[model samples]
Target: MNEDFYIDPDIHQSYTLPASVYTQQQYFDVFKKELFLPSWQWLGGKEWSDSLYTQMPHSFLPGCVDEPLLIVRNQNQLSCLSNVCTHRAKILVESPSAKPFISCGYHGRCFSPDGRFRSMPEFEAAQDFPSSKDDLKNYPLSSWNDFYFTALQPKYDLNTILAPIHQHLSSFPYDSLRPEPNLSKTYHVRANWLAYCDNYLEGFHIPYVHPTLNKAITYEDYEVRVFDHCNVQIARCKPGQKPVPLQKGDPDFGQNIYAYYWFVYPNFMINFYHWGISVNWVLPKTTDETEIRFLTYKRNDIPDSDFADTALDLTEIEDEAVVESVQKGLMSLTYHRGRFSPTREQGVHAFHRFIYTEVFADSENIAP
Candidate 1:
């Protein structure tokens, strides 16, 4: 492991992660185990609960983790189970179907939807038949509101990580939201996943990179509140601009809040707006390529933002262009690392610190 990428605890003195962190394939491999494997990842929203969509097959982070998983719904209770069969390691589920039970097509091995071993052919004489090891493995599944999440090995509680956001947005109606499939989309970028995230962690580039968004939000008042496993960027609307309505006793009751951008460490992002929330996952395809999935969940009980979808599309194009440029810049021999702006880039500083601690350090302490 490279100790040179050490991020100082203090923001004022901290240096950015070295270019090698993004350019090297080895570091990317390390990230798979250290950063992503144990972290909670957004799986899908309430839409998956539809009876027709049961037994959905998914591969966690595809090119990265590549763990075959099945989201099974048995009697309306959802569970995430390993899709690989214990017998001969064949993939159990290949496509989404409303199947009542799991069956391995390779050898006729069978199991329950919840991953319990049911029956197997020609194993009558086998010693200690149908042990617990014959059952499919189950991963940890969690939910916030109706959105589901799962992890190969969870390092922190999903609810605990999201608690701050819940408290901050006290009066925001969560149960009244539903997925807007037409508004959801994906973008492929020619840049390291971290590069895109680093750009998102701060509002420093909004004036230059996102001129339209800067005009809507008061950039000078932008604030980032960092927690142990997540960080939120609060963007307040400009004078005379429309702000998301807030109730009394809310955290930002008097402020003209535009949106709350919550970044769960490593990949997932949830941007809360008056109309709804845009959920994003920065999935890694390779050392230098990334796939970003944007899912829009709109509110049913309130008026929606007329321009939210357009704004999302425009901002993504601008961000993609700059991040792709940074990918090319990382390959340059002249630049290695940069410094952080203590006031404006606290979120970025905290992110680098997380990478350093989780990916490089020998200890797990995150505080400075």
Candidate 2:
């Protein structure tokens, strides 16, 4: 039987997820399969500079999963396929291009752009040739704007993960948001991926850790909303800070909304300002290390300097220092578990419950 880990539904009775979940290799291995693969992961950017969107071939979860995949756009239809050769397991596509179809560089095995197996050299002599095995395997794909996502085996509905995000910002002109290469940055943190996420899921640290951010947004009004498979923390503007004018009929109308920080389970985050969107994709590279990519997209009216990198970068530095300390402390024999703040840490508790539930879905007995 799988080792069970329980997180109480009642926040008042619950403790944080066990320290082993962050520090142990066994739990990390389990999460890679049961938690991450079943949840949709941020694959790649689909922002094309050309008139036609070309065939995009890239490795899925580059450092970790290392699954070879190709994003094929044929006649405006998009599909994701295994980039491995059917003949001898050679990688099919290595780069992005405007190719009509895929031909394995190793043996010249050919497939249609949408992954339909067309032909292969010298295979005419083979008996019972060209069955379903010859075709490239396709994964279920979903998109939000130019971004793409897919699961190895899906547990949650893609729409359920996305609908809330869209409805919240449905009134905005989404197509106007364009990618800004200069504003995008990547950083490696010497901490568990979940630790970084846990720190982000709550605003409890803003007052003490992020003084500038604390001044920009009122600490008393900050709110975190937990959804089915995601959560969002809303920040209201402080006295001198400018609030993104909330439209009438909107859920947050009459409030001074500063930023809409949304966390889509496991790793991806979409932080929306009136100026643009800051997308954070946290990738688990190892049990104790994670790589975070900060991709920014904004409307033309929003100046490059308006993105607030100063506050963002400074806040990140402070956050890293704290979470890194927590990472080191997790290794201590005395630090087994911690408690959650009922009012301020419901999001963190929600995340723990999710991890426990996903990891123990097939367990013979639940943990006490």
Candidate 2 stretches with Cα past 4 Å from truth are: 1-4, 45-53, 361-368
Q: For model 2, where is the 10-residue window of minimal lDDT?
A: 44-53
lDDT tens string, model 1, 197-233? Answer: 9998889999999988988898878999998778999
Clashing residue pairs, backbone N/CA/C < 3 A, model 2 = none
List ranges where model 1 is wrong by over 4 Å. Answer: 1-3, 304-307, 363-368
| CA lDDT scores, all candidates in order | 0.87, 0.80
Quote the lDDT for 84 in model 1.
95
Best-matching candidate per lDDT? 1
The digit string of per-residue lDDT tens for model 2 on 1-368 reads 33236788899988888787788777777877777778787765536432264577766676767788887887766778998998999988877777787888998999998788999988889998898999999988887676678777889888888888776776654567877778788988999998999998999998888888887888887888888788889998877666654566668878778899999988888888877778898988888999898887777765665667667788888988888988999989898888889999988999888877777555632333
Clashes of each: 0, 0
What pairs collide in candidate 1? none
How accurate locally is residue 118 in candidate 2, as Cα lDDT from 0 to 100? 92
